[model samples]
Target: MTEGTIPAALDRAAEHFAGREALVDGEVRLSYAELARRVRQAARFFEGHERVAICSPNTWHWVVAGLGALYAGATLVPVNTRFTARETIDILERARVSALVITGTFLGTDRLADLGSARPGTVLRIPVEGVEEPISGVTEWDALTGLDSDFVSPAEPDGVSDILFTSGTTGRGKGAMSSHRQALSVAGAWADCGGLTEQDRYLVINPFFHSFGYKAGIVAAVLRGATMLPQRTFDVRETLRLIETEHVTVLPGAPTIHQVLLDAPERANHDLSSLRLAVTGAATVPVALVERMQTELSFDTVLTAYGLTEAVVATMSRPGDDAKLVANYTGRATAGFEVKLGEHDEVLLRGPNVMLGYLDDPDATAKAVDTDGWLHTGDVGVLNERGYLKIVDRIKDMYVCGGFNVYPAEIEQVLSRLDGVAESAVVGVPDQRLGEVGKVFVIPRTGSALSTEDVIAHCEGELANYKIPRFVDFVAELPRNLSGKVLKRVLRKENG
Candidate 1:
C-alpha cells in the first residue's frame, strides 16, 4: 500500500508503474514516468509560491498544475469553475494565493480577463479550448512547461496540503484544511473499498475543484496506478464514446449522472460491457436506479457513500451489498472512522481523516470538533445494528442540489443585499430532475416593487448558478419563533 505525502506517492507510482498509462485527457496521453517528469518541471514554476489556486475545468492541465504545486510544497486551493469573478476573488483573497492556474478561454469566457487585477502575482493560463485573446503578463501553459529546474520541496506528513472551501451556517465560506497524511489516508481507504487496481481505467466526471475529484479521484488513482480519463465537461455522447473507446471500467458520480446515461436514447448503441464498478452518493439513490445500473448498464458493483468536505469517504457501501441496501443506506464506516449517533440522532465521526481544522478559524473549529475529538456532523442519520448509516435530515438547513452542497444562509446573505428585498429565506424543495432545488421566499420592503426575475437577476451577478434559487415566491412576512429566529422548518414544511 502507498503511504506518506502526495509527492512521495507520485514518485512511487512513477517507479512502480513507470510504463503504465497515467492520464488520458483528449489527445494528451502520459505514462507514469512522463507525468512525473512534467510535474517536476511544473513544480519549478511554483517554487517560491506559498499558495496556488487552480480555477479550471477537469483536464490534463489541471492534474499537472495541481500536482506540481504540491510538489513545490505549496498549498493547493481549488476554486469552483461556476463561481462568478467576485466569488472567485473572495476565495483567492482569503487563501492569500500567490500563484494561480486558470483556464484561458472556456465556453466563451476568458477567466484571466474576468479576474482582472485580482489575479495572483504568478498566473499560468491554460489554453483549454485555445486562448481567444492572449493577455499580456500571464504565462501560458506551454511557457511554464518549458522551464527547467531541479527544485523538489520536502513535504512533511503533517503539513497542510490543501484548503477546500465549504460554506458555513454563518453565511461565510470556511476553508477546510487537511494535512498530507489525512488526505492520503482517506484516498487509500476509498481506493481499497472500490478495489482500484492498475488494470482499471477510471473515468473521472467529477470536477477536480471538488473533494470527490481531487482526493478520491486523482489521489486514489495515483495510489493504485489506475489510468485516469478526465472529462472536461459532462456530455452524454462524449461519456458513451469514452467508455467504448477507452474501455473504462470504473465510473463514479452522482446518481443524476448515471440516470442521464441510462435514460439517454442512444445508450443502447454504445458498448458498455467494460464497466465494472459504479460509486454514487451526495443525494438520494433510488433502489430502481441501482438495480438498473446492474441489469441495464452491466455494472458489476454499485456502491453509495455519505461524506462531507470535513471527512471525505467516511462511510461507504461494500461491493457485495445488494442494490436495495446500497440505495437505501450509505455503508458502514471505513478509513478508521468511528461512527455513532449523538443528540437528535446526529451523526458524529471521529477519525484520523477528519480535517485538521477550518483554516484560521479557531472558534469555528472548536464548535465543530469537540474535546473528545468527535466531529459533530450536523447531519441527522440512523445507525442500524449492522453498522450501516442512513442519512435522514440536515440540521444545518443545507441541501444537495445535483450533487452540490447548497447552504440556505449563503443565498439569504446575498439576497439581503439586493434592493427592494427587505428580508429573505431560502429552503430546498424536492425536484424530479435535480434531487432538490432552492426556493426562496422574499418579503419585499415597504413600497418596493420586486419581480421574480429581478430577484433571480440580482443573484446571478453575485452567486454561482447552483446557489441561486430556482423558484421565487414573494411574501408579505416571514414566520418566526418567539425568540425572533426565522422558522426555517416552518418554511420547509409549507413548501413541501
Candidate 2:
C-alpha cells in the first residue's frame, strides 16, 4: 500500500487492532479487520473510476463508501444528503463524477429517488432506514462489499483524494480539493489534539459531508483506532441514549447540541458518566456554557476549535488553557501552521493542512489563497497577547450599522447569555435611518414566554444602542446548513 494513502493507514489500524471495535451504526458493529476488508472489497468494485460521488446519511456504510472510493484511487466527492435535486445534479456535473453511491431514504427524504434522472448512471444504493421497497435498476451496496479484498492501486501522496463542496452561503458552492497528505495532516492534527485512543468510543453528531465530521470525526478516529458511533441527526434523547449505551467517551458537535443536552429534562436520567472529552465551537462560545459542560455535563475538558472547509483543524484550544480562553478564543495554531491577521484583521493561514485549491476555479482559488502561500480566511479575528485567536465574525457576515462596523457575532453572544434565550442570530437588514441595522431572530427557551420586549430590555445594558437589533423576531428554530451554521442569507432574504 502507498504510504500516505488512506488505505495504508487503514491497513495499519486493521493489522494492529484487528479485534478492536471500529464502527457502530444503529445495531451493526464492525471491527477494524472487518471494516478494512470491506473497504478493500468495495474498492475493487469501484476500480477504474476517476471520480465517485457519495450522498449518504451518517451511517457505517457512509464511512465504508468513502474509504472505498479512496482505496480505489478515485477522487471522492461527498454531496450533502440534504441537497435538493438541482443542487445534487449541479455538483455531479461540476465534478464530472463517473460513479455514484447514495442512500435510499432518511428522515422522510428519499435522497436517491429525489435525484431522479438528475444522476442516471451507475448508482449504488445503500440500504438506509426508511426506504423499505427495493428500487429498480439500482445496484445493491451489499453486493459490492463481498468482492475480492486484496488489491493495491497507484495513488501519489500529492494526488487529490477528496473534493469537498462548500456550504454555498454566498454563491454556488465550490469544491475544495484536498490531497492525501493534506487529509492525513488534518486527521493527525485532530487526533493529537483530541487525544484519541483505542479505548475511546467517539460519537460524531456532525454530518459526514462536512470537514468537521469527515476529517476530524471519522478520519481521526480511524487513525487512532477509536470506536466510532455516528449519529445521523442531533436529538437530545437519542444522543444521551447512545452515550449511555455505547459508553461514548468523545463527542464533538456544534454548541446547539450541548445547549439542548444541558437543558433536557430527561438529561439526568441518562448515564453520561462515560463522556470525558467534549468539543464545541461557534462564532461566540459563552464562557458559562463551557463551565456548565465541564461541571454539569461531566466532561473532563471542553474545547472550542476553529477551522474552515478549506483547512481543517487550524487552531484548537489546548487542555490546560484558561476556561475563558477555551470558551471565547480559538487557541494557538496547530503544529506546522502559521496563523496571522492579514489586511483588515482577516485571518491568514499557511499550513500543511491547506487544501490544494478550489476545483476547476482558478479565480476563486487565487482570491482565497495568495501566491505567498497564505490562505485568506474571510473570517475577521483578533490575535490577543497570548496569540489565541478571538473570532469577531465572518467578514462577509459583518454589516455596518450607523457608520460603525457591527459584528453580529458579538451581539449574538450577548443575546445568548440572556436568561430566556435558547439560541439567537443577528443579521443586518436595511434600516430607514441607520442604513443597515441588525434584525435579530431568536429562539425562545422551551415553556418560557420570552417576548420581544424582554429581549429589548435585556440588551439595554449589554450592548450599545447602534449595536442593538432594532427588529426582533421569535422563531421555533434558526435556519442552518448541514454543519449547524446559521443561514444568515436566508434570514436576510426573509427580513431584509
Candidate 3:
C-alpha cells in the first residue's frame, strides 16, 4: 500500500519478490533481490554525482543503473544507445550530465571512456565477455556487482529524477525535466489501464531510452511485479522463441512489431497462446494492421495507445473497447485529461500528466505547454459525436493545395488498403502553382509485381482529386526511427 512515489513503489517490489526473476537478458536472469542490491551499490557510488547518463540496452543492468540514480538522488539522463557520438555529446552537454554508464563497443566507440575523458564526471564501462579493451578511469561493472548490497534508498524527494530528451520531431531535441512523481504517474496510469499483474511476464522490445518503454514498458512491469524479459536488439525469430520458451504474457511495442510478428513464419508454429495482451502505439497505425493481428494472431486483448515522450501515455484502449473502436482511432485521448481540436484540427491536450517544462529552453517550453497547461500535441484529430477520437494527421505534416487542406494520412490509408502494397508514406512536396502537393512513397509487398501506375490508379478512385498523390516514389523500405515511426522528414529531404 505504498502509494506515494516511484522509489517507494520500487522498494515494495524488492520486498514482494525477493527471489523472483525480475529482469532477464539472454540466459541471465536477476532476481528482484539481486537487482535491488546492485542498484543500492551503484546508488552509493552516485550519492552526490551531478547527473548519471546511462547508455545501455533493455537489460537487467540498465534497470539497476536507473534505480541507482533514483536512490542516489542524482538526476538520471538516459542517452539512446543507438545515438551517434555527435548526438551523444549534444544530449550530454545539454543535460550537463558529467557521469556516464555505457555498454562495451557501442557503434565502434567506447562511449564510457570517451565521456570520462571529454566530460567532467565519473564514467563506468560495462564489459561484455570477450569484447572490449579495458580503459583507465572507467570503473568495471563487475567490481560493483560484488559490493555490499545494504545501501539506503535516499529520501530526498526534491531532486529531478530523469531528464529525458525528446526525439526532435519538430526541431532540435529538448530535455524534459521529469521528477520521480512525474515518471511514476505515467507508470501508474499504464498499470491501471493495462490490468498489470505479477503473473504477467513482459517482453521488453522497445528501447528503454524512450519514455514509452521506460515509463510504460519497464516501470509498469516493475510496479505490477511482472518479470521483464529483455532483448538487446529485436530479431524476429529470437522474439518468437523467447515468447514460446519464456511464456511471456504481455508485449508492448509499436505497430510495426505487431505487423512483423504476425508476418513471421514461426508465429503459426509457436505456442503464443500465453500472450494474454498486447499494446501497440508510438505512431499512427493502419486499421488493416490491427485487423490482421486479431484474425491472424488471435490476440483478443489488443490496445492501441497514444502518448508523447513529454508525458509518456496520455490515452489508451481497454479490453471492453468495441473491437471496431480500437480498430479506428488511437483511443479516447486520456481520461484524466481533456482534448480539443485547434486550428487545422490539431489535437490539443490539457492534463496533469503534461510535463512542467523543457529542461533549459523556457521559450520552447512556453510554446509547447500553454498558460492554461494545455500541451499542444500538433496532431490533427476529429472527435465524432459519440466522443470517439480519430486522428486525421499531424498539423505540420498537413499540406495545402490552392487553399484546400489535405491530410496525408487519408491518402496513406487509402494507399495501404490497395492490393500488392505493403507499406506507404505520404508527404507534402513543393508545387510551384499549388504551393504544396502530396507525394506517396510505396513499398510493394514482397514478390509482388505492382507498378507505380497501379498504385496511383488505385488511389485515384478512392481519394479526392486534390488528395491523390501527384508523384509516387518506390523504395524497398521506409526509413524509420528506432520507435518504428516512418521518418517522413527524411523522405521529404530526399525528394527535395
Top of the candidates by TM-score: 1
Ranking by lDDT: 1, 2, 3
Q: Any idea how many clashes model 2 has?
A: 0
Q: What is the C-alpha RMSD of each candidate to the true structure, in Å?
A: 1.4, 10.6, 11.1
* Candidate 3 clashes between residue pairs 3 or more apart in a chain or in different chains: none
Residues 421-452, candidate 1: write the lDDT tens digits. Answer: 99999999988778999999999999998999
Score candidate 1 by TM-score against the native: 0.98
TM-score per candidate: 0.98, 0.81, 0.78
Candidate 3, 1-496: lDDT as tens digits: 1245556777788899888888887768888777777878988777788788988877777888888877777888888775555557778888888678888765455555554446545777666433576676767787786667676666444447788886443425688886777777778778778788888889988878877668887778778888998777778899999888998888877676787788787778898877878787655566777777777766767887777767677777877776677868667755376777777887788876777679988998998888888888877888877556677666567665532446676677767788888888888887754556788888988888988789878876655456678898888988999999999889888876
Alpha-carbon shift of residue 403 in model 3 (angstroms): 31
Tell me the lDDT of model 3 at 161: 73
lDDT assessment of candidate 1: 0.92
For 1-496, candidate 2 gives per-residue lDDT tens digits of 6898777888889999999999998878999999998988888978989899998878898899899889899999998765666668889998999889988777776777777877757788888874457667788877875689888866668899999986333435789999988898888887888788999999988888878889888788888999999888777899999999999999887766787789999998988889998887744567888899888889998888888878877899888776798987988888478899998999999977788999998998998889998998888899988789888756677675543446677677778889889999888987644457888998988888888888888776555455678889999998999999889989988886
